[model samples]
Target chain A: MIAAVGLVLGIVAGLIYEPTVPTWLQPYLPIAVVAALDAVFGGMRALLDGIFDDKVFVVSFVANVVVAALVVYLGDQLGVGAQLSTGVVVVLGIRIFSNAAAIRRHLFSA
Target chain B: MSRLALGRLAAAARPRATRGQLVAAVLCAALGFGLAVQVRSNQVAGLSTLSQSDLVRILDDVSQRTARLQAEARDLEDTRAAVTGGASGSRAALQEARARTRTLGILAGTVPATGPGIEFTITDPKNHVHADVLLDALEELRDAGAEAVEISSVGGEQVRVVVSTHLVDAAGGIQVDGTLLHSPYHFLVIGDPRTLAAALDIPGGVLDVLHQEGATGMVAQQDSLTITSLRPAPRPQYARPAPASGR
Candidate 1:
């Protein structure tokens, strides 16, 4: 419940502020978002499984965003930014889907 | 995946608002903020999803369309020029045809002609000047580049002389083109005056023959004279323009 409130509050704050992202960071923002989504799903699954840890959850979320953005940045340097971003999105998407499936089964008993 | 042993032990007796939930809330907050920002940026740019190859293909298509449109414009311009210039082209053709008509009228002796030329007067008191002698004089004038000629009897009749004019002796005079001509017969000719006078004064020329016949011939140069004699345009009876030859 608190996590959902925080997510809503952050979205409202982002909408109100309408912050200007710098040009160099714009390319990796979407990839970071997808990675963060994957991390959230994973955290949700762990919580339902009764194995969630504060340090592990926080570290994984931060590490997911950082690593995803870093790989895209390196790809840009290597002149393969488009291909690398695609790869990152695909992997993150699969993880998010599987975690969401696990969470769905736990909550619905279906 | 193996459970985090210390985390599993800590969460064995789960509590509300645990530290893990607090951290999860912050991470979720960050995730939500990122999602909002990426969504806003996507709406603003709207082109980041397109690959470089796709953009290049679109550019190539637009360039080809522009080249085709330019060529079509040039073709339309040429067609307009040809259509609008039609009147001027016809006008030029009409002017050339009129000029040709005037030239033909002069050559056919159906129009009065004027230029520098000589006047030849023969006083034949005894009617010693015959048709053949007059004919010889006309031939000499033509050889000397006389462009127009008319034979006129003083205060009598004027007859325009052409290439096919007929001459014959008659009662005490000469009949030219069925018109009786008595002395003094005046010949008004259009040509180079100096050349015509030189041709007449050559040894064994017209003046010499007239001198031997006891008839006197006089030649005078004039700067400008108009032969007012105009011939009736001839209607060809047996001859017509050939099929393929320029006039």
Candidate 2:
């Protein structure tokens, strides 16, 4: 219940404040969001599987975002930014889907 | 031994929900919040309104517009250079002299002119095409910016028709510089074809007057109308160039 309230508060604050991301950071925001989504799904799956760990979840979330952004930056330097962004999105999307399927199985017992 | 050791290490590092469930929940909440915020901001950024093809089309349109504007600018620059550089003393004097010679040649009807212009043929079946009607046509053509004019009788020699010196003969044929032109006079004019045609065809204009006089007048535009009849330069016996006055 506390976690649900925190999420609601975060959403209300975000809507009311409407903070703008810095221009230099704009390119990385989409990738970071995708990575965060992957982490959230993985955490949810772990929770259903009885292995949920806050430390592991937070660490993985931060690491996922940071690593995704770094890969994109490296791709830009190597003149393959678009290709690498696609690659990253595909991998993270597959992981999210698998975790979501696992969570579904846990909840439905199907 | 290596497989047993690796399995032991993985087992030791694995997380248990019983110990860190609260932290896990908090982190999951944060992740959800961040995702929502990113999605909202991206929506507000307005990049989603344009698809990839739209962006490419916009880029192409901008490039084409730039190219057209650059070409116009180049043309304007060339005109500016021509005006400024062509006005320097010796070049200016030469250009002035050439212009004066051309004008004098046109007025004197001694030079052939070929340009977009109009031609008109007046058939005076009853010899009712009077000198005044012909004069009116000349005045109208002059007002309409006709650079050169020639008139010839049906199947006769073409003559440079000068307005100031031509007269209508008693027999109703036009006489220009001792040459008698009969009915069915064909006029060749060099000027802006549209303007010249409009001037002659205006309501109650020269064409109307000619039609009233029982003369059939027909005007047509030509891409290139040539007037080749040359007139002898008038020998001025008295007027001579004055000596240059000293400052």
Instruction: Report the lDDT of model 2 for residue B136.
Output: 87
Error of 1 at A68 (Å): 15
Question: Tens digit of lDDT per residue, candidate 2, span B185-224?
Answer: 8889999999999999999999888878888899999999
lDDT of each: 0.86, 0.78
lDDT tens readout by residue for model 1, B78-130: 99999879978999999999998887877789988999999999999998999
Error of 1 at B200 (Å): 1.5
User: Scoring model 2 with DockQ, what do you get?
Assistant: 0.13
Clash pairs for candidate 1: none
Span of ten consecutive residues with least summed lDDT in model 1 chain B: B1-10
Local accuracy of candidate 1 as per-residue lDDT tens digits, A7-88:
9988987777878766667777889889988888887788778876768888999999999999988887787878898999
